[model samples]
Target: MKKATMTKMHPRCNEHGHTVPIKQPSKASLAQAWADPQGIATAVPDSAMPETINDVPVSAWQGAPTDAAGWEALVAGLSFTEPPVPSAPGKKPAAGVVTIEPDGRVWVVAPTNAFGGYRHTFPKGKLDGLSPRASAIKEAFEESGLQVELTGYLCDSVRSTSVTRYYTARRIGGSPAAMGWESQVVMLVPISELRGITSHPNDAPILKALPAKAIVIYEWGLASGHRVLDTLAGHFTRYGEWPTRIAIPTGMHEGLREEILSPYGWRLLTERLKVVATDAGALCAYGARGQEHSYDTNGPVDLRKRASEWIWNVDLT
Candidate 1:
């Protein structure tokens, strides 16, 4: 030690060529460490909760303890309602048209040589490089061989591939016989007969929304009388509207029922509800066929009451 004196190493390199020692990093507080790791939490510590709680003195809760721990415990015990979540992503749009005659007959299409033509549906198609309105117009032409002008947006319904947007339209030209290959037969069906004839349940709402005169024909003797009413009422309430006609017992009134069932009535009643009487003579005389159905009256009174609610709400001007 006397022969050679050693100097302490400096933190920084010296001009004299002495070795420099590496400096160690300072340790941070637990909170600071947590904050540093998480980019969100702040390193700045919050003061501990107040020893005394600033209680809101209401008549019902005035006598509650004001200790901070007790207040925290109370708050912990309280429940909160979660916010509502947004609707799921919407399905792609399928544009289509709903054509209705002045007499409340809706145009529908039957698939040719398919399923024995047992199912009838509205003329609608997927949007293929056309605007919604344009697509609807095109679909009407292609499926029903009819030219139409869109009147208004009717409603939205779900399909196998996407959601369908239906637009109300009036026929301007074209013949149903010339319908495209997609449809075997295209024709006008009465609004009241729609739900029964249409294979797709979704189309019922469109029919219900159409304006039409209702005929309620019933017979006390028929076991299906009440059932028919119940089914019709269910269809009406579900679709937000009522049928064009209903059949009740003949004895409910004295005069000839056929006398009141006029052409204007037939245009309105020309086609009886498929759920009602299936007399071939009556259907043919009215220029239609007997309805094929299986629906029976479940609760005629309750169903009628619900249908009445919708009827009362309708704007019948």
Candidate 2:
């Protein structure tokens, strides 16, 4: 029963029934375990893929899988992609919102009602069951009232009856005084003008559940605003992204110079890593979106002079 009470074990029974024990879960559970999606689309195993992304025609990889474990299981199933392909058989879970402004235009929405006063759409909806990733974040703040923050996941189409999901939120907080009532005809289109708007011919189920190219990766068990010393319980790793350290930022390093980046799963393959930041800014995440950072390290020391305070390396094959 040592090791600092062993992070807290669990197994209970009590009342003389002989088994008592409980009290440790201070927090951190999130919980999720209920997938079925028609047995993951028939678990297609036949491989020989390469159907696109620079010469993949030949009628587009018929039964994909030519070798290397069926092309690394068709590139790890397109780099771990799944969910949203159920547009027909009993569909429901909906929610949309690509919203990417700052002069980038990616807020395509569809679905209107009124004609002269309210007839626009695309800040979609229809998810309350709880998790189409939390209903694409409550249907993008209930159809563009604002209040967004997801920063990831922009797929899930499901074809026919309606499976939507398309998220990539950003706004940050409710605005336009907080919209609702189906967003009174929301607008905001750009991803290349969204083909002249008024879409929804079923918008090709969010452009065939988008994903032709996008990839980025890098992460390390983080959370050290400054006085870090959790005893390296997680001992996070992946440290080599783009080396050549500290030419700046000192003390609690003004807050881990954030610039999160996630492309993981499409951009084919890329790497240019080199990290070393502490004093609270020592993280240079990538894929799961944590882009580039340098926590100006000043403690956990040891890595050489700059104590690894800065110096990452990644050649990405």
Alpha-carbon RMSD, each predicted model: 31.7, 24.8
Backbone collisions counted per model: 16, 61
What local distance difference test score does each model get? 0.46, 0.36
Q: Write the per-residue lDDT of candidate 1 for residues 1-317, one digit (tens) a residue.
A: 56964533322233365544312111213333221211111111111121211121111112332343432342243222222222225666677777765444567776543433446777776665555666777777666666666655666676445777777776666555455555555545656566766766666566665442222211122333234445555545444445554444334212223432222333332243322344331211111232221233222334644433343333222
The C-alpha TM-scores of every prediction are 0.40, 0.23
Model 2 segments beyond 4 Å from truth? 1-94, 97-123, 126-144, 147-150, 154-161, 172-176, 183-257, 261-317
TM-score of model 1 (CA atoms): 0.40
Q: Residues 218-262, candidate 2, lDDT per residue (tens digit)?
A: 222234321221111112233433223222224423333332123
**Cα-based lDDT at residue 6, candidate 2:** 44
State which candidate has the highest TM-score. 1
- Model 2 lowest lDDT segment of ten: 37-46
Q: Pick the candidate with the highest lDDT.
A: 1
